[model samples]
Target: MRFLVDECTGPAVARWLEEKGHDVFSVYDDAPGIADSKIIRRSHEEGRILITNDKDFGGKVYRERSPHCGIVLLRLGNERGQNKISVLRRLLEEYAGRLPDQFVVAAAEQVRFASKEE
Candidate 1:
């Protein structure tokens, strides 16, 4: 799958996803300091799922009804960097096949999936 990693997410997550053979674009390296709306627009235009730690994306996508391919909001809190990465890795490992066409909120202990219908 292709992904646009938001600036709020750590670089390690992008590196790890690339290592796992997914096409990954990281805003941190590609376009530093871009606004959230522009980043969301780019992700939509490029047909990429957005992986972000920013809850603001949720409001923009859902409340504002922004167009997007998909979004995965990582909601893990107060964890070590490595632990956060591990959570992301586990999410991909367990849900790679089911990730598309849905909005996913992945917390440390649970994952919630919502679609346009929901």
Candidate 2:
């Protein structure tokens, strides 16, 4: 899988993804301080699933109708890097094949897939 890790999502998660053999582009490492709109646009253009902690992206995709290859929105109760990685690990283990072109919200206990129109 290819991923665009948002700046706020941090380098640890990006590193973990890389270790898992996913092609990863880290905004924190490659392009710091970039705007959220550009991040989403770049992710779409590159055909990368965006990994972000920002709720604003829901508005961008749902309300503004922005196009995306895929998005994994982390709504974890524990925002620590390890917790994020654990949540992502579970999500990938269970739903990797179903991820593309979906808006997925991952929490500590559950994962939800939002309808594209929603």
Candidate 3:
């Protein structure tokens, strides 16, 4: 899978995804401090899933109808760095196959998926 990892997601998540043989581009390294709209446009142009911790993307994607390849909004309850990485890693390991073309929320205990009809 191809991913455009947002700044708040941190380097750990990007590295883990790369290690799993997925193409990962991180805003922290590639375009530090860029605006979210630009980043979302880049993700759409590149056909990469936008993986972000920012909840704003959900509103932007749905209410604003932003163009995107896909979206994975990590809503992990734990704010610790390790906890975030762990939950994301587990989500990728267990549910990656179900992620494309959908808006997904991955929390510490559960994963929720949403699409246009839902």
Candidate 4:
């Protein structure tokens, strides 16, 4: 799976994602200082899911139907790389394989999946 990690996410997370063979790009390196909407659009255009701690994306992508290959809205209290990696690992282990068709949110206490009916 391809991913576009937000600047809030640390470098180790990016490296581990790449080590897993996913084409992962950090917003800091690729879309540095870009707006959320633009990042969402870019991720969609690149066929990559977005990993972000910000909740605004959930509203933008799910409520407004913003373009995104997929959405993984992370909610890690501590922004440390290790915590992020652990949360990411659990999320991927649980749903990355069986991910649904639309935007998804991986929160600290819950994992929410939303998709439009075909």
By lDDT, the best candidate is 2
Query: Which regions of candidate 3 are displaced past 4 Å?
Result: none
Backbone clashes in model 2, listed as residue pairs: none
lDDT for model 2 comes to: 0.95
Give a tens-digit lDDT track for model 4, residues 25-113.
89867667788888888888888888888789877865787866777777767778888888888889888864534667666778877
Residue-level lDDT of model 2, residues 6-113, one tens digit each, is 999999999999999999999999999999999999999999999999999999999899999999999977899999999999999999999999999998998999
Candidate 4 residue pairs that clash = none
The residue ranges of model 4 lying beyond 4 angstroms of the native Cα positions read: 116-118
| Greater-TM-score candidate between 2 and 4 | 2
In order, what lDDT does every prediction score? 0.85, 0.95, 0.86, 0.78
Tens digits of per-residue lDDT for model 3 on 75-110? 876766678778877888898888877899988888
Enumerate clash totals for all models, in the order shown. 0, 0, 0, 0
Candidate 2 lDDT at 94 equals 96
- Write model 1 residue lDDT over 28-70, tens digit each, in one string: 8888899999988998899899998889988887788888888
Error of 1 at 96 (Å): 1.1
Off by over 4 Å in 1: none
| Candidate 1 whole-model C-alpha lDDT, 0 to 1 | 0.85
**What is candidate 4's local distance difference test score?**
0.78
